[model samples]
Target: MNTIVQASPVTEKSRQLVTVATPENAQYLTFLLGGEMFAVGILHVKEIIEFGNLTEIPMMPAFIRGVINLRGAVVPVIDLAARFAGEPSQPGKRTCIVIVEVQDGDLSHDVGIMVDAVSEVLEIPANEIEPPPSFGARIRADFIQGMGKVAGRFVILLNIHRVLSVDEIATLAGVATPGEGVAHRSGS
Candidate 1:
């Protein structure tokens, strides 16, 4: 969680420079959350695992559902719904955790994000991607990569790095960790 990310790296396959209708393609892994379709760059995805037990840490932010031990490493699991300041998500039959590697500083940390269900990997043309709107989005504008047009519909492209920023989340961890001298901030 102490990792630092300068920026999200684009995969070699998606390294093509995109301009207006240039045919340059990028792949995104699509998923459902709160009845809306959202996607993250495929390059960031590690693997998908079934939702299971998580060790809840006390006094952390509500969005931080808990931590899970993945092959001896302590990986934190985040509720994307709550992270967006929405209601907590209830894991359903199709619910699962998507393991993603987030670059922080020079190191990469594995983090888990809960999604209602994973849809599919889609190759979208760069021309079909529109810059994030300045307002009226359910989540923070900084969290959006773009709005992608697929099959005449719009899918929110998530800027996972921004959404899972280690520095920001680390602050929350500090607030919860004993001896940090920061009281937990809560609001109804």
Candidate 2:
């Protein structure tokens, strides 16, 4: 005797094949400043280096920790906490310098930003992003792109162009004019 085996029929819904479109996610290099997490677009980040001795420049803003020689290039380092919140930097083992490319006037300068810690690169979906709050942010809202929801908390996404504006940095650098004991004032 021959036996016939029947296969289960596929339903219309099953045949439709529900495809969860992977949401377009952006990758950001996350870092910690103070107690909060902040992210910068990965495209701008060049490299991360351990905190080390920096050559201090006179007459510069307090935020400008000074410059470091990286492969023969003089790159200025900015303390993110001091620059944003006007607080002093207390670097620890996790402290690192994230070298980035910033544009100042007609010049594109390579600058280093010091962070409390270097967090992992995060892939955040666009839908999970929210607009920057008008009042809740510790730093100026203009400096932020929006708050990103990550692991049930918000990570502040920085608008690098605004946060590291060349004009602003130049202004800060200009505060210490040529001569007139810039080094003494900066404690260099």
Candidate 3:
């Protein structure tokens, strides 16, 4: 006698994928300033360009180097060293401009920070960063985002927004607008 065996049908159910919050991992573009290493979050950085001619505006703050024409858009360049209250950095062969976007309210401006040299981009785990110290920092405490520990070295991560506060700079410099058609050039 032959027996027929029946097999059960297999059913597939749709599964929904869910995402969970994870630790933040940030990347920074490192650069040298005054023989020390500094960094800024890569997201804020637009591009790195060769140091070029800048149209100097008169009566501007000492840290405000000048403005450069970037693809027809004027970009103000800041002397990072000078901004830190140190002597201005003399441009060298490796000198380059790091373009960063700073936002104010609903408007964003492209500002260039002059660095002695551009270093490598590093991926630093968020946990490895330490909060900015309350005192003894060469630059203002607000200017530092955190101190990133990298290979036993501390990299000063700059809070670009604080360092390049558009409103504050304009008010302090008494300039109309940085990178805005070279305003305030009459009173040198």
Candidate 4:
């Protein structure tokens, strides 16, 4: 019989993984931000891209770095650091953007989160996951989905939906609907 292999939550701490057996498994895409590890479910991940060609929008919040032309789609890129109440990210050599799809009511929107680097995807058994703590996290507690144990360490699994809530972000940033938001800059 061919054993089934699956992905789980993981963060590379000198290349180690941790897990526990459960009836179901989950996969997570791990990445780094400010030297800390974070993961998001693979289902939400659309693609990962090299960070570049950002068209900065005026008067937007710091976390809303700008928009990128992703295959003709205007995907907004977010700076996780800034969103987490830290200084803006200074793009590094390993900097990249992880594209994720978020739902707003009946519609879906694509958003990009810039990270310092992309780590490997791993198969995390459900039993190894722990509930989010009430406190002691760098980011807001509500933003965490769970904590995944990995090789005696921990990876902060993010509640991507809550973290990237389209409605909340737009409202907080004072962004208007597409038609009313951006003014065309001619020959800039």
Candidate 5:
């Protein structure tokens, strides 16, 4: 399957600076993955779609469940569970895909992330957000953006950009397309 991302024009709405939205009023789209609460900044979110049949491609990474033709664009669907853990995500009644926009240089691409279910959008205050724990996280430390405290509970704020990095994933997946210039780490 061709996974090259085509660039689209940036919109005026997206031109608003992220700094304009402080944590005090920042919104997050919370979702469940492996029964754990996780969130992504709403600004990075494009939309959420119902779970649908996907076209599977052979020899791809396990985390890469398949691709879905979103409109006319071929968007790759990622199994979030498989990416973080080592197993594929099981489809549940509330299963769905969250379309997230990831930046590649000056261009943007929309990628689908499979999740157990979407909870709600919440406003997490600055005081309630804390730095990632030094350890004890199920996922890699770099994946976490922060720990948001809500209703006396902690929600994992994901660094979506890092998680959905096309070039990084493509390089690490051993399918780096020429001219993408996705640098691979030495001696993993």
Candidate 6:
């Protein structure tokens, strides 16, 4: 799959302002996955929800944990670790779901992503961000826009739209009716 990375545009005027306001910076919602910290652009995040009951969908990819009712809308939730790193999620108190809006073609859809924990929102200066490595990244580099340095550690900045745009997950509800999978669970 071709993952599109949006680069922060730089202009001469913006460069001059960077000395003070740092206009190249983009706000990111930092979160935890496994033991590492990762972030997604703040523009994509809609809300953060404490882990709750998820109605499972049968015959779907294992990465798809299930769906959650968000104010009457059934949003499919995907386990980030399993979806990217191919491992099962072991939930803890810190686990939570981040609701985000993604665009598929011309349609905008809201999807929920499960993360180990919700951290803080941070503004990463463009200069502190480096393009994703061609190799050595644990997960597919396509899912990453770049790596941002925060508190001296690298934070994987994910391209949320691309990460959850898999064809199967997009068509799950349309193909299978609700409550088709394993029984609903009380928490993550």
Which candidate number maximizes lDDT? 5
lDDT of 5 at 61: 79
In angstroms, give how far residue 29 of model 2 lies from its true place. 0.7
RMSD of each: 7.5, 17.3, 17.9, 9.4, 6.2, 10.7
Q: Which wins on TM-score, candidate 2 or candidate 4?
A: 4
Give the TM-scores of the predictions, in the order they appear: 0.80, 0.78, 0.82, 0.82, 0.82, 0.77
- As for candidate 2, its clashing pairs are none
> Candidate 3 on 19-107: residue-level lDDT in tens?
12234757788899998999988778777777867778767778999888777677889999999976788999999888899998789
| CA deviation > 4 Å runs, candidate 5 | 1-23, 177-188
Report clash pairs, candidate 6. Answer: 58-181
Worst 10 residues of 1 by lDDT: 13-22
Identify the superior model by lDDT, candidate 3 or candidate 4. 3
Assess each prediction's global lDDT (C-alpha) against the native.
Answer: 0.81, 0.76, 0.81, 0.80, 0.82, 0.76
Which parts of model 2 have CA positions greater than 4 angstroms off?
Answer: 1-23, 104-106, 175-188
Q: What lDDT tens digits, residue by residue, belong to model 2 across residues 1-188?
A: 22222222455532322223234747788888998999987767767777776887766677899878777677788998988888879889898888888765566778889999987878889998999999967899899998899999999999998888866776567643223343233333
Supply the global lDDT for candidate 2: 0.76
Cα lDDT of model 4 by residue, 6-123, tens digit:
2222435323323322348687889999999999887778777777778887777799998887766778999999999768999998998888888777778899999999897777
CA lDDT of 179 in candidate 1?
A: 32
State the lDDT of candidate 1 residue by residue for 5-106, as single tens digits.
Answer: 122245542243221222465888899999999998887887777787788877776888888877677789999998996588999999888889898878
Clash number for each model = 5, 0, 0, 6, 0, 1
Model 6 scores a TM of 0.77
Model 1 TM-score, 2 decimals? 0.80
State the lDDT at 66 in candidate 2.
81
